[model samples]
Target: MIDVEETYIENRVMVQPNHANNLQTAHGGHVLKWMDEVGAMSAMRFAGNSCVTARINQVDFERPIQVGDTSLIKSYVYRAGRTSVRVRLQVYRENLRNGKQQKATESYFVYVAIDDDREPTTVPELGVSSDRGERLRDEALAGEGQ
Candidate 1:
């Protein structure tokens, strides 16, 4: 069994002019790309193999992240099947100076482990070893969109 915490991944990206849209806010495409990358990393960590994005279960942009702000992304594998791993991803717009943050986006992604031939491969089971990890898993499963 793969521990939930072991599959966790966190990344930070400082929004720049190139990443912004016409409104000077971070482009939705860039944000989604970041989420996908982090989610894939988490899934691969849990599967112990290369994993590819099989599905974007859902993505909700709660707030816009402006240019010059930092985007903090956190991802973790909360569930796993024989060949698939489900990851929960969250992005926050953080104020570097004051250390305040707001939820900018949240989503769930599914990834499939792939073998050398690029065919689907079995992935290890996931198990939560801590109360916090269990709570996180349950909360992710019982979300607004599941």
Candidate 2:
């Protein structure tokens, strides 16, 4: 069993000119790519095996990550099946100078563990050993307007 906290991952990327759209905001595709990478890393940590994205829930871009700003992506595995893991992911727009952050996008991602043969492999059960882990699991469960 792997503690949810142990699977948690956070990454940051500075939005560059090439990452922006005509409006000078970070492109949706770039944000998504970052999310996918972070989510995969979290799932791999939880499963102890290579993982592949199987599904992504609705992603809403609430705010924009402008050029010269940083994007902080946070992800953690919340639940797991025999071979699949569910991750809660959130992206925030960050201002390095002011240390201010505003949530930009949030979503759920499902990943399947794979073996060396590139076949779906069983994953260890997700463990919630601490109060923080339990709280994060609850938060992910209640995200769908529950």
Tell me, by TM-score, which candidate is best: 2
What is candidate 1's lDDT per residue for 1-146, written digit by digit as tens?
88998988899999999999999999999999999999899998899899999888667788999999999999999989989999999999998989999999898889999999999999987999999899889988887375
Those runs of model 1 whose alpha carbons end farther than 4 Å from true positions after fitting are: 144-146
- Full-model lDDT for every candidate: 0.91, 0.95
The alpha-carbon lDDT assigned to residue 25 of candidate 1 equals 96
Clashing residue pairs found in predicted model 1: none
Candidate 2's residue-wise lDDT over 20-130, tens digit each?
999999999999999999999999999999999999999989999999999999999999999999999999999999999999999999999999999999999888989
Q: Best candidate, lDDT-wise? A: 2
Residue 37 lDDT in candidate 1: 94
- Whole-model lDDT for model 1 versus the true structure? 0.91
